[model samples]
Every structure is written in C-alpha cells, then in structure tokens.
Target: MELRHLRCFLAVAEELHFARAAERLHVDQSPLSRTIKELEEELGTLLFARTTRSTRLTRAGRLFLERVPYVFTALDQARASVQDAAAGYHSQLRIALSDGISPERLSRLMALCRQDEPDVAIRFFEVPLAQQLKGLHEDLYDLGFAQSADVDDGILAVPAWSEPLRVAVPARHPLLAHKTIPLEEVLRYPLVMGDPEYCEGYCRQVDRILRSVDQVPLVTEQVKSLNLMMALVAAGYALGLAGASQIQTCRESGIVARPLDRKAVLTTWLLRPDAEAPESLERFVERVASLDAERRLTT
Candidate 1:
C-alpha cells in the first residue's frame, strides 16, 4: 500500500473515531474508510472492529500501533543525520532526569560526559516521569530516567541504577527515635506522597507494601517532586518516601532520612527509543549504564 494509506490508517488508529480521523486528515468520511479498507486488503487483516458509533483497534491494530510510529521516527532521524553531516557538527545528546536524581549525581554525570566526550554537546530537561514517557514517544528527549512501566515496544529500557528508598522524618518527629522505622510504624503518622499518575511504578510498589498489611496511607500531602515533599517533611507536616540519595545532604538541613526495617526501595531505569538515536545519545546511555560500576558518591 502507499504511504498515504498507511498515514490514513494511523490517523484512524490514533483517533479511534472515523469522523475525527477524517477531520484530522482533512478528508471526508467515505475516503478515509476506503483507504482503511484498501490497507486491510493489502495486509489481509482487519485493523479495527467498528460499531455504529464507536471504533476500537483489534489485536493486530494494537501491535501495528507500536511499530508504525517507529517508521516515522526512523525517517525523522535519517533527515537529521543528513542535515547534521552537512553542517560539520558531530552530534548532540538530550536527556531527561526525574526529580529523584541526587544533585551530586547530576553534577558528576555532567562532569563525566564533558570530560570524556568534549566534542559532544549535552542538554538536559528536568522532566517528571509522566512527561518523560510522552517525550520519549515524541522523540523530544533522547533518554529518560524513570521506573519501568507500560513502555511501548519501540522503547528500550535498561536498569541503570538504584538507590535505597528512605523515609523522611522531621527532626522532632517521634519516629526518629527508632534507628530503623518499620513501614507499618509510619502509618501512625500522616504521609506526604507523590502523584501516582506521574510516578506510576513507584507509587504502585509503595501501595503494594502498605496494602499487604491492610494499611492505607493517610495522605496528608500530595506532591510531584522530592524537593517539595522533603520541605513538607521538614516543616513537620508529613513523612515521605524518596530515594536515599535525595536526603544524603538533608540531615543537616533539618530533615532525617532512615531506611525501612523491611525491604522497601525504589528502582531507577534508563530508557532509549528503539528507532534511531544519535552517537552522543548512545554514549550517554552507555555511561549511565556503567555509572554504578564506578564510584558513585552515595550517602
């Protein structure tokens, strides 16, 4: 089939509505349907199952949706390659780090890349986990650090590094008396928490731990970043769960961090889109993968 047919199919696949897809493509209803029919005929499979008022992608459509975007990504990368080659510029890397990465870790990462790959220019975006997922799909960011979740097929994620999960307690808080606080024990105090819609995987794991003992966290505060969450904890508002690295420098800043008595922690990952990443992007991925192998200054 022609590329136009594929585009039409993709439009319908995305909107999941015949009329909307037709409007998006700047075409009328009948032509869009015909194009989808032609594509189905060529592929020998029905992509969508339709009713009078609604449409949904079939299993085949779901699989195809994961792949078709890669085609466009490859095309975009190819054009960028040619343009960069002609311009005499080597390559550029763009990265997105979640708020959980320690300030020291970020400083070291920047230093390491600049020292080792001086010819490459690096840019960083302080993105939340939810935005990172969409940016990865949009090719807006080359790589992202987040917990693994429902990632699409065209994205490849590697376990880069993990920090011990710690409980943030205020200095005068009664829980500070214990050298190691139990997860169940923390239920006595209100909790300041992250927004699950943005940080889905971490929130899910935290919920599983508390739910096992039939406990519901008294969420006194809902926050998206560790900085604000820690601030609230320091202000004697609520306790919080965050990476140990985040609180390494906070003990003197009036916030106390302690490990949970049972096994409780958060894991971070490095994700790369599958289509085509620049050389600089690939190098950053490799460096991040090997970061733990080196001496990471963790508290």
Candidate 2:
C-alpha cells in the first residue's frame, strides 16, 4: 500500500484508540478506519482486532508494526544522504542520546572518532528511549546511547560503562549523616526523580531498585534532566538519586553525594540497530569497548 497507509496503521497500533490515532494523524476516524481496512484487504490479513471498547493489534499487525519503521527509515536515510552530499560532507553519522551520557566517556569516544574518521561529520539528538528505538529501527540514527536494557530483538544493547549510583542530598540533610545511606532511609525523604516518560530506562532501573526494598518513593518532583534534579536537591526540596559521574560533575552547591549501602548502580549502554553495522559504527563500538577496558584497568 501507500506510505499513508503504513503511517495510519502505525498511529493506530501505537495509540490503540481510533479517535486518538485519528486526532494524532489530523484526520477523521472514518478515513483512518477505511485506510486500515484497505491495508488489511490488500494484504489479505487482518491487522487489528477492534472492539467498541478496546482495540488491539492482531498477530499480523504486530509483526508488521515491528517491520514498518524500517521503510520510513530507508526513505529518511536516502533524503539525509542526498542532503549530506549536497552540503559537501564526505560522510555523516547520526547518534541519538537518551537519559544522559557520561561526559568523560563520551568525550573520549568523540576524540577517538575524530582521530579515526576525520572526514565524517557527526550529529547528536537527545530524545526519549522510545523515540530513539524508533529512529534506530528506521535507520535514522547510526548509534544510540541509553540507560535501558529493554530493547527489542532488532536492537542490541551493549553495556559500555557503569558507575555506582549515589544519593544526592542537601547539605546537613539527615540522610547525609551516614557515609552510606540505606535504601529505606533514602526513600523516606521526598525524592526529586527523573521523569519516567523522558528517562524511561533510568527510571525503570530506579523503580526496580526501590521495589526491591519494598519502599514506595514519595517523589516531590519529576524532572526531565539530571541537572534540574540536582538543583532541587541542593535547594533542600527533596533527595535525588543519580550515578556517581553525574553527582561528581554537578556544580550545584549544597548538594552532597553519598554512596548507597545497597550498592545500587546504573549502566549506560550503547545501542545499535541489529543489522550489519556500518564500518564507522563498528569502529566506534570497538573504541567504546576499548575505553571500557582501559577504565577497568585504571580503576
């Protein structure tokens, strides 16, 4: 079918609600439904199983959804390739960053890339995990960095580096009395935490850690960035949790970072589309692995 059909199908599949999908596509529900019906007819298979109360993807729809992003990805790459050629760039690399990357490690990686591929221009996009995943599958990004291991089979996540998770407290906060704060005590204070929708992987890991302690976190504020979370913590608004790298690099005053007694940790991972990776991507991956090894040796 046409690209519109695929777009409509994807919207419906993701929203799982006819009205919402139609609104998202800025079209009426009837036309969207007809398009989906036509797609199913052309394929000779039902894509979605819809009820008045609930709509869900059928097996075929589920399978198609898994593959459709690649079609748009190919189109996007072609456009980007032509644009890059017109701009006189010899080569281009698009990378998506989610959660937050380690500044130290990322700097080393960039240095390696510049040394190894002097002619290649690099682009970085800070996006949500879901968007990054979509872009990766669609070929919009050559590589991605995120804190989650919840990738689909089409994407492989390699742990590039990890740092001990630390608790960020306002100076003189009761929790700071202990050199290492206990999980339950950290949860006792209201937390300024990462927004789950924005920092899905990191928040999910935090959730898992909190759940293990059977403590419900009283989140005072849900922030989209680590810097803001630290700011709030320093202001004595709430306690914050972050990796040691972030806490160490934070310039916010009145924030003391202490290790957790429970040894909570977060890992930043390198994600690549599970296809035959490009030569540049392969080299970058090797550099990342090498950096990890170097870090381990020095530490």
Candidate 3:
C-alpha cells in the first residue's frame, strides 16, 4: 500500500529469509516480519511460504514481484520531475552514455546545443547498455549513446557517428613497423579486449570483425575500462583494440595507434524513445546529424 511496505516486501521477496531481509533493510526482524504480515493481510494473499528451514515466495508473491519494481521506478521519476520543476527550470534533457564515445565530437555537440538553445539544461548519465534501454522506456532518459544499433521495436537507434577501428600497440613493438596492421596479424598477439558484459555493444562489434580470422583470438585480458586496457598494452602484455578517438583522447603512454588494413569501424548510435520528441531535443539531434554528415563526407 505504501512505499515502505513495497520496499519491505521486495527485500523479503529477494532474500527469502526473514532475518537476512531484516538485516538488509537495517530493521529489527520483529518489525520487518510485522510489516510483511500487514502487507499480506491488506492484500488478502499469502505472499511468502515459510518453514523451519526455508522461505520461498508464493505464486501470488511471484506475480507481485514482477510488477513491483516499476512502482519504485515511477516514484523516482516523479520525484526527479518535481525537483526539476521546483528549481524553476524550463526544460531538461537527460542523456545516457554507455561506452566510450568520441570526446571531441561530444564536446562539439554540447557546444552546439549551448549556442543554439542556452535555456535548455542537459544532464548526462554514464550507464550500461541495458540500463540505458530500461531508462529510456521508463522515461528516465531522453536520449542515449551506445556502440550498437540493435534495439527493441519501440526504441529508435540511428547511426550517429563512426570511427575507424585501430590497434594500439606498445611502442617499439615489432608490429609498429607497418603503418596499418591486418586484423589477422593483430589477433596473433596477446590481445586485451573490452569485456563483453560491461562493453556489450563494443564487444559485439569486435566479435563480428574477428569472425574472419581462422585462428582463435589470443585474448590475454578483458577490461571494462579503456585506461586499464591501455595500461596493459603499454606494459607490452597485450595489444589493445579501440577506435581512433579513444586512442587520441587517451594519449596513453608507451602506446601508439595504427590503422587497420580493413575498413573496420565502430559505430555509435543515438537511441531515443520512439515517440514525438521535443523541439529542443529535435534541434540538438539535427545539429548532431549535420555534423556527422559533414564528417563522413570529408573523411
């Protein structure tokens, strides 16, 4: 019935142990039990089944659990909306960023937005690909940038920018003899790649590119952060693969980037809810689009 009740129920549902759940909620076990009991009585359903040794959710509880998270999400969105309104802000744009986007391009786009519409405030969130998709659907984010274009039916993913994929080799490495390295040659060395879990979009693109190689990739390390990967590469432990923008922006010590022989590119996409966009957002997106078009033509 109340937010606290839902919180208690969720905690109990997840832990399936009264004492553990109480500890997690930072409450006494007696009151925690009372809260869950009250919730069950109010709903006229048994939410949990308990025995001396174990506790599990009832059928009703399982169904309720499926829908309870959305309630909290809605409450959070409402609170943020009220706070923004109280601050006397006319409009706000929330953008979620997943992976490493080109820093130079992001700077230029933000500058364009400030020049065109200084009144609208913009906020950025560094999130995972899954979180970005969830937030967009829940109205928590207005736009998102990710490496992949794959999205659900109601979400629109438009290609926003593309950077040529390059190999970051340690200084004085033998491969540095060639200006552009072949993918097959790069795979022959110990490679430090992005982790598939954190960098899902980027890893997916890398996987596609590696499909051409007959030899299994000699992956020495998988890292979630580019800085860590660069460090590993600089140590001569492995070769790093990344977009030209990342290598340029990082300026990592003891690491030099070389273009790949093939035209392998990492594409960043603009993800938005498939609904009518606000005029301010439309203007910002259009500016990004024009910039991307120009960059493509010149390159």
Candidate 4:
C-alpha cells in the first residue's frame, strides 16, 4: 500500500526471520511484526508462515517477492533521472550488458557516444541474458549487448560484432606446443568455463563449439566472469575458452591465448524491443554498426 509496507515486506521476505529482519531494518521486532500483519490484512493474504523455531515465505509471499524489486528499481531510476536532469543532461539511455561483452568494444562505443551526444546520460546495467531480455520486453532498458542472438518474439537481435573464440592456456602448458590447439586436444585437459546462469549466452556459444568434438570436456570450474576463468587458467587449474578480445584484455600473467583449429567465432548481438525505435536508440544502433565496421577493417 505504501513504500514503508514494501520495504518492510522485502526485508522480512529476504531475512525470513522477524527478529533478524528487524535488526537489519534497525527497528524493533514488535513493530516489524505489526507492519507485516497490517500489510497482510490489507492484501487479504498470508505472506509468511512462522513456527516456533523457523519462518518461511508462503506461496503468496514468494510470488510477491518477485515483483517487489521492480518497485525499488523504478524508484532509484526516477531519482537518477532527476539527478541527471539537474546536471544539464537532456535525456538518459538505459543500456544493459550481458554475457561479459568485450570490454574493448564497449569502451570504444562509450567513447563514441560521449563524443557524439554529450547531452545524453548513459547508464549501464550488467545483468544476465535472461534479465536483459526481460528488461527489453518490459521497457526497462533501451537496448542491450549480448553474445547470443536467440530471443523470444517480443525482442529482435542483430549481430553487432564477431570475434574468434580462443583457448586460454597457462604458460608452459602442454597445449601451448601447438600454435593452434585442436578442439579434441583442448578437451583433454580440465577447463574453466563460464557459468550458464551468469554467462548464459557465452556458455551456449562455447557449448556449441565443444559439441563439434565427440569427446567430453573436463570442466573443473564454472566461473561467473572471464577474469575468474583467466585466473583459474593462470594458476594452472584449467584451460579457459573465451573470445579473443576477452583473452587479450586479461592482465593476468602466465596465460597464453591460442586460437582454435576449428576457427569458431563468438558474435555479440544488439538486442532491442521489436517495436519502433526512438531517435536516440536509432543513433546508438548506427554508432554500434560503425564501430563494428571499423573493427572489421582494422582486423
């Protein structure tokens, strides 16, 4: 019914313990309990089930939890928009990044945007592929960059950039004996791969490449980020599979990036809603295309 109600509900839902939630909110347990009761009375549904020893969310509570964060996200964005307007920005762009987009490409694109449209405020949200797609459909993001072109009906995906997928090998590793490592040979050793949950598109692309070979890969670790994967590889824990640009940007020592003999390429896609595009988004899309063209020319 109010901001306080949502805040108290979220705290209780997250903590699942009234006393702990009260402590987290810096309030007494009695008031927190009364607030939850009042919210339940207003909603006409039970939110949490509590026993003498434990507390947990009911089905209604779990469902309500899903929509609660959007309220806060909208509020935060509203506050940011006011701040941006006060700073003399005419408009703001909400861009999301997923699947560990190439840092070099993003840096170049950002530099171009700042140069071309200094009045536009650019905000980047690093999220999973699913969240990016959902935000696009929900009008939470103007556009997003991801490694996969796959999407549902409401979103359109366009290929923005492509780069070779390379193997990250530790220095002095046996795989380094070959200039271009074969897929079967790379699979022979343990690998540090991107987690499907955080890097869904990247994992899908890498998985498709690995499927070309009949042998099963020995994945020793599933990392959430390329840096962690490179770290594991540099420590001789396992080899890593990542885009050539991602590997090139790694500052970790003792990591040698070798191309795959099969020449698999990872493509980054620009995902947007299928509806008509705004002028700013149109310009941004064109900028992305120009940058990709320049990259292809130099490479």
Candidate 3 ranges beyond 4 A from true positions: 1-83, 86-88
For each candidate, the alpha-carbon lDDT, in order, equals: 0.78, 0.88, 0.88, 0.92
Candidate 1 per-residue C-alpha lDDT over 1-299 given as tens digits, one digit per residue, 9 for 90 to 100: 78798799899998999999999999999999999998899899999999997899999999888677656655656666667667665776767776455666667788889799776655566656666776788877788777655477788878777778889888888898899998889988899987776666677667776776767779987787777888888888889887777777554368988888987767677877887766677778778766767756543
Which segments of model 4 are wrong by more than 4 Å? 4-38, 49-57
True-structure RMSD, every candidate: 7.5, 5.0, 4.2, 2.4
- For each candidate, what TM-score against the reference? 0.66, 0.73, 0.77, 0.90
- For model 2, state the Cα shift of residue 10 in Å: 17
Better of 1 and 2 by TM-score: 2
Candidate 3 lDDT over 205-290, as tens digits, reads 98899887787898888888898989898899999889888888885789999998888989999999999998988987898899
Runs off by more than 4 Å, candidate 1: 1-89, 250-252, 295-299
- Candidate 4 or 2, higher lDDT: 4
Better of 1 and 4 by TM-score: 4
lDDT of 4 by residue, 1-299 (tens): 88999999999999889998999999999999999999999999999999999999999999999778777767878898999999999999999899999999899999999999999999988888987887788888899999988998989999999999999999999888999998999989999988999999999998999999899999888989888999999999999988898999998999999999987999999999999988999999999999988888997
- Model 1 scores what on Cα lDDT? 0.78
Q: Give the per-residue Cα lDDT of candidate 3 at 6.
A: 97
Error of 1 at 36 (Å): 34
TM-score of 3: 0.77
Candidate 3: residue 50 Cα off by (Å): 13
Backbone clash count for every predicted candidate, in the order shown: 0, 1, 0, 0
Candidate 2, residues 1-299, lDDT tens digits: the string is 89999999999999999999999999999999999999999999999898879999999999999779767766777787788788777888898999977776788889988898877877787888998998887677888999998998799999989988889999988887898888889888899989988999999888888898877889879999988998898899999989988888888989898998886889999999888977877888899999999989999
Best by lDDT: 4
Candidate 2, residue 156: the lDDT equals 95
